[model samples]
Target: MASSFSASWLRGDPRALEFLSDRFRHRAARAEAVAAAASRPLAPALHEVLVARNARLAPSPARERNLELLARPGTTAVVTGQQVGLFLGPLFTVYKAASAIAAARALAEETGRPCVPVFWLQTEDHDLPEIDHCFVPRNAGGPLRVALELPDAATSRAPVAHRHLGPSITGALAALRAELSGNPHADEHLALLERAYRPEATLVEAFADVLSSLFADEGLVFLDPRDPRLAPLAAPIHRRAIEEAAAICSKLAERGQALAQAGFSEQVHIRPGAPLNFFSPGGPEGARYRLDPTSTPGTWSLVGHPEGASVTTAELLSWLEREPLRFTTSALLRPILQDTWLPTAAYVGGPGEIAYFAQLAPLYAHAGLPMPLVVPRARFRVIDDRARRLLDKLGLSPDDANAPRDELLARLAARDAGEAFETPEAVEARLVSAFASELARLGERMAAIDPTFAQAISRTDKTVRRGVSRLAARYGRSITQRDQTTLERVERLRAYLAPDGAPQERIHALPYYASRLGSHAFLRLVREACEPFSGNLKDLKP
Candidate 1:
């Protein structure tokens, strides 16, 4: 097996993530400018929840302790996500939350702004299957795979499944603590985490409960949109969002038709006319949907019915007009809210999150929101002692990590030996030529010994070729080892970008987030490539 991979392996996709990372490295100044004006109340409701949750099991309660120090007026809210696990994925799931908290603290120190980071638990996300897995470092002794422990009579309806949250999470955390031998207070940490995520709470609230431990001492307020008081502030946004979503849905129908005509089996849906997301009144009871009847099938609700009463486009628009504030908070209202929140100085996001944010810029402007400045989350490329030692042994540079492993190995080997061997193809060709020459010489000698000499010579030639083939393969494998080491490292890093795998690499995932970091990154290098395309917003065809 080959060892190394290069940025080239991502093909010529300008939107490839690897390329975007390279480009974004130069845009640090722009990001700083955007982070300048953002502000929030120090002791936001969200931060308090985080502290309380963390305090439950924590021996010292650092998260809660930190919240007490910084809980005050004039703080900036830092937000991020976690996949219901401690192990962050290739996309830096844990780091996203950590960075937000860290950056908030750092920013608070610098700007004199009390910064508190909030971890938004995506409980409404229906991809139950995706959140079930967690990665453990090799030294941690392999990855842990866990599944939801749904009850026998558990219906898709809220109450049955709602009860599953606390146990499943507690059980999973316990299992993880048990697996890690000799880790100090593993049980305590897990217990503290359990206090953070409560079954009766909203996904956002549950998220606050667990993540609060990380920043509770900062006096962070854990605001749950599920909180009835906050509901009023967000409700208008929610209702309008749903109404706006109806229009977006109409646009999507037209776009889908065009995609179908273009011979696409699966459409790249942007919800062009639809809003990005909406807040619901209660968990499951106030469920939000992208469209009443999704173009894609199998969209039955928990009770086996469509989400809302099917209404004509005109009727939906009228409903939005009647309760503009309420519908504004629906998926229909997303584009408008984004527009309302516009001139957004900076939006902290992971690479994929950035890409989806980019997609909304045009829609935001169309909906009258200012185009916000985009910033990648604090990034990390982990290099442990083993990784460092391996790099040193190979005498490879950080830049070399971006090169094709096989090529880098060949180069390294040639440098070490002061000479290089022929390519595998060339070596194979030489072997074939040598076998032919030997067979010719043997054929004449064989004819002198017997009449069946030609057959004998043919057999001899086959034997010689087989021997060369075997020898060549053995040599190839040995050479591949050098490249394999590098390849493994690159793949490991790639894993963080997408734990499940890259969006395009997957069967049905969206390139929305991946494209955000990658495409935006590549834009710097290949601005000229796309400059020919006008700024005109081309209407998606019906």
Candidate 2:
């Protein structure tokens, strides 16, 4: 396999292009050229927004407890969380959350924030079906890929005890290892993974334990959204939401005919109102919520029990008016539950999360909540040390890595050609001489047709100039490709940097946390983002 290049060299010649087939230029040269082009300062608006938003928001009471734990002398926390499918599959995912915890403590120490990390279980997300399983790379020992697996009804909601998780998780690890044919250390890696998979603990617990030692001083706190205390906090909101949802269903049913004609889905855009389901810190349910899928399907079902035989939009509105308390409770309680415990100042998330938070900005405003500033998550493309060495040889950068394979190779050939050609002035002078001679000949031919054909002769002269220029350009492709690797690289980079085109698919799978940076790196980055950013839900990337 060909080796890759490192960032240092790639930055050197941002616009260098090469043809690998030519063998004169290694791929690294192109990479270095591209990286040089891509690296630039972040937009001013983004930076200002981040600093501004980080200044506001705090955590709920439960989170406050965790925060206080970190505040204690020499204590820390490892933290991470996911939208929903976080717990579905893959051992690397566990690492990502744990890594976030490790990163938080590291940053905390550097900044003297005494930060501890914690994982927030997104149990309430109604999109439970999405987080079923994980896929790893097809190659056994190399990269990672994801495949989806559905959770059984019981394990789906209730916090999965460690006993229920360990064996099955181990099976997954073994399968992953078996798939990786040439993994030299597959056995050892599997052993490490097996130890990390804690079946007796819930998903949050298992993740925390996996990273336990990383934050030995600034320890990890695990929070399951299903915890009894938290559930009830969401109860009033949940109840009111369910009731209002029924009404929404009723309205949808009534409008079904019209909506179908308009080609719209049954999705509703919820806005907080009258029956504020806000709960206080001391709610009886202690802010606990069960991970039941019914909350969602119930809202959509066409027929059901007491809430109504069938729901209408008006009924949904009535339920909202009836149970304002429940809805507000969840929002008010989140800060107390998580942020109050950590000294969080920012939230980092992917694009979707960022957009979702943006959508909820008005709700936060209405509830007297401070919206957190959102920052895009750290993205990485892993290339091993060998690739780095190869990059060094070719003097390339990551940005140059994606150009057409043929073009890259062609660059190498051009570099080897190394022969300097005549300058533009010389070529222009030759063209001028040739054009003058051709025009004179054309004039003679026109004169032979008629002495008064001067206009036709003039037009023929202009046409000859245009045609010669076109022919010259046609003959110059190979010459240009040979002479200017930098220009070639620039052209290739432009293809990718186009505003409308996405050169590669972004990885959003839960396991991305682990596979990209390993568990420790993943956890720390996420926790740092979530703790501070959660307060400003508007800041979370969609």
Candidate 3:
């Protein structure tokens, strides 16, 4: 089906178009040119670690089959990832997974090679505030942002994966249940959430459990980098980053400068003498610190806590070998580590990721890994019957919903005033034209007589125009007050379209829709509606 949505932003965003076609040129290459680049298959030991991780999550038959496929000689993965979020974060999370699956299936069909879809759970991310909250509209109006917070006693700068949901999750779930109580599938959605977000469950486990249940049949594999078993596999990449810290830093600095010169901002900055890897000062339970080189050659200290301890190059290597899990790649180096661990054919991400990849072309080359084809994930805007009726009542298109609340209301009020109210605007335009012509004739006559007199005529014309503009503003305000009901309808439409001045997909939680539409039905709607490599915003109607 054709998408019901339109995104004018896509027309002008060069990065979005670049990701869609996988080319700097307008046209894409043929099938043969698009063939997957050969990379070494996953080693048996690494494959076992992946399988064990999936087994812990209660893998489906399809996931098991995909895990088996990973062991094959030529199989490569089409990968995407996000932070473990509340109720799977925003709708874009689902869209990203669907995009990866679509891209993988298309690649498999085109090349006749096994290409599996994988979602790397960003369990190592320590930023708790980012994933702690999700927005859900209560009663189809303004959104309520529900936050699941860690307790003061338990709070630390540790990775979110290790943080338990705790008692606060109960209140958060209750809030969601109350908001979603009226729908037929409300119980089912709440049950799924409760099961995944139990008080004792860690954030990473909850995210995996929920996603596996949602997309089990699609054969999407989930990978957690924090899985201790995979730490050994990541050791080589980690070591190289530390050993070549100075060179990597220099390269990143040069590339960041080049990007700025080219009129694009660098997403990740390079800190001089800082290692591309983060070092956990207190081991697994401690906060992570950036490794910075010390004044002594071949020695380094943590960026913020330099007085804590200094490690020579030899000592750093020993620490990596003994405690591989303690070392994590910086944002700039994470993609390199991902490609190292998985034979990735393409890495699917949003627009911001695509821009950063432009800066990392040099780093990919330095790592001796081919830069995977970067593809834009699908974008969606979900619309229920209530929102549809509101749009129709307001004489607004889906695209019109993007306007600010005040702007949309003003436009609606003007339309409600009809042509009778607009007659004054027409008359004002004619008056302005007549006055312009008369002033020009007067100015010509005055200039012919005395050059300075023309300046006086111009000033008089400006004063007259200012008076007319003020009068027009007053007329518009009066018309708007007369059509106050239309303004109220526009307000309701704005709530659905752009809550808090942001798109619905960026704000609303997944369960909000699961309640409006049945859970299974909503999943099917997203899966079937998404098109491979189509970056346009889709409007999903229920």
Candidate 4:
């Protein structure tokens, strides 16, 4: 799960760590101190929106108490969120929430002040393809992609809140039923999904329902940014963003450059003449539109239209008053908006998110918001018992399983019963070396007779090397194909631990494990596995 940027920051590349507020600490004492001093009044509208949402869900005394604390004065939040993915998208989604909950608990204990966990629902995101699928593990030991296929769903630009799960969900469920046919927990979990993801429920609603069910006892508040009531609370920030739009864009570009100089790459692209926000027309079908500055003073052009309409700044500000939810922050601006309005002690993020924060690090000061501690979420390289046994039988490490399917199988097959699987590689190396030496001697002799003949010698040498490599690869594959036992073990090992060369936590869904462990046990394991403030990924049973 580590990107070059994330590995730099998380593994303590000192230059990379400089972008953060604090580092090298296993406790939230310093962050708690900052949050204690950074007291701000709650966004008046959010309390009602959050409390109402929580009331509609299953009863959890712990969650109920967290909700109460969130409404009280001087309560700080430890927030993390994801796009409303089907069945909670990837496993990291759960890891993110667990990290936030862990950070919140540490903060409350450290400061003796109220702190609560909040999961912001990114319902405004319009990329349907990103959230339409969930990977279920098969009985034979591999991933099964259970996706809802709606032709319109793929082509539409509408936000997830508008994507009603209609009849297409039945197809996805049927596919899931087939995958989980022999699973014992299938009846209970599928029934839970059927109830949550009904024909009438929007994608966001179903995601919230399932996620809330899992974390019912954990008290993670789900906040919808599109809630009409909260628009007024966000108005001042929106206005300031519009008025100082160019300046903010300039600051972001400069920060992106600074990140590059520090040996890191920018995660969010900063465009010239574009501000840190998007404009939606405020309807179920309206797509999120990008706004660009016009040459005329205080006028702007909406980028989505083929023929852009020039609207004055006054007109844009009016939308904030009448339909303020029309305006939402960009990837970089969202942290500012969240931290400014909510008393955030820390923000739990994965590698990519943390890398983005580095690009927008200085923007907090530009927006006049108190920067929250950006904590790297605890990571796991999940492996089941079956995968463990295969790895041992093949004498391969967990890291070795991350290679591509054919290459990894080739490696394991080479170590199988006979030298047949490895003979081609030895033959290839010897042939290439001998051919290169002969080619060099031939080239020298030809150069003495005619300088042009040296080029032919070089070309022949290159062709010979390429042909041998392909033959060796094909030979190894053929050998592996003949050994059905090795093939099966390699498939089982790679499929469970590193599907498509990514960790299981990233490729598989919560139910992939929960179906095996049961909800209560899975949740308990997640809570216990959360190594808050410890910037490291470790092996765990759950």
Residue-level lDDT tens digits of model 3 in 456-519: 8878989988888777667656665666567666666767777777877777789988887877
Worst 10-residue lDDT window, candidate 3: 1-10
Q: Please identify model 3 stretches exceeding 4 Å from their true place.
A: 1-21, 24-38, 151-156, 294-296, 299-301, 304-314, 420-484
lDDT of 1 by residue, 1-542 (tens): 22111121122233333212222233453344335434323324444554554454324445454456445444344455444432222335533544455545545554454455545443433334454334443332223453345443223322211323545656655555555434434444445445654454433444444444433443433333232333334444544444565565554555445434433321135544444443222334333334443454322112233444333445444444443222213222332443232222334455445434423433454454444333345544434344455556667654455554344554555465554665444576798997798778878777877878898778878898888887766665566565555546544433322223432112111111212223223222222221110111111110
lDDT by residue (302-406, candidate 4, tens digit) is: 876655655678888877778787787777878877877688878888877887788776688887666677888878766666667878888888888888777
Query: How well does candidate 2 match the true structure in TM-score terms?
Result: 0.45
* Per-residue lDDT of model 2, residues 1-542, tens digit only: 21121111122223111200111123343233223212322233322332232222222343344444443444433335563332334332343443454445444544443444555555433333454344443211223443223345333322222113434555555555566434444454344445555445444444434434333433444455444434333443445434454443334344433333433222223332212232222223222132111343433322212233333335444444454332232332343233323333333344344333433433343333334322233333333343344444545664555544434444544454555544333454588678788778877887877887788767877787677666555434445555455444434332322111332213233333244344445345445544321122211121
Error of 4 at 439 (Å): 3.2
TM-score of each: 0.54, 0.45, 0.85, 0.92
TM-score of 1: 0.54
Off by over 4 Å in 4: 1-3, 21-29, 36-38, 282-285, 306-310, 392-395, 418-429, 442-454
Q: Estimate every model's Cα lDDT from 0 to 1.
A: 0.41, 0.39, 0.77, 0.77
Question: Which consecutive 10 residues in model 4 have the weakest lDDT in total?
Answer: 21-30
Error of 1 at 345 (Å): 5.1
Candidate 2 runs further than 4 Å off:
1-80, 83-115, 126-171, 179-189, 196-208, 211-217, 239-344, 373-376, 389-395, 402-542
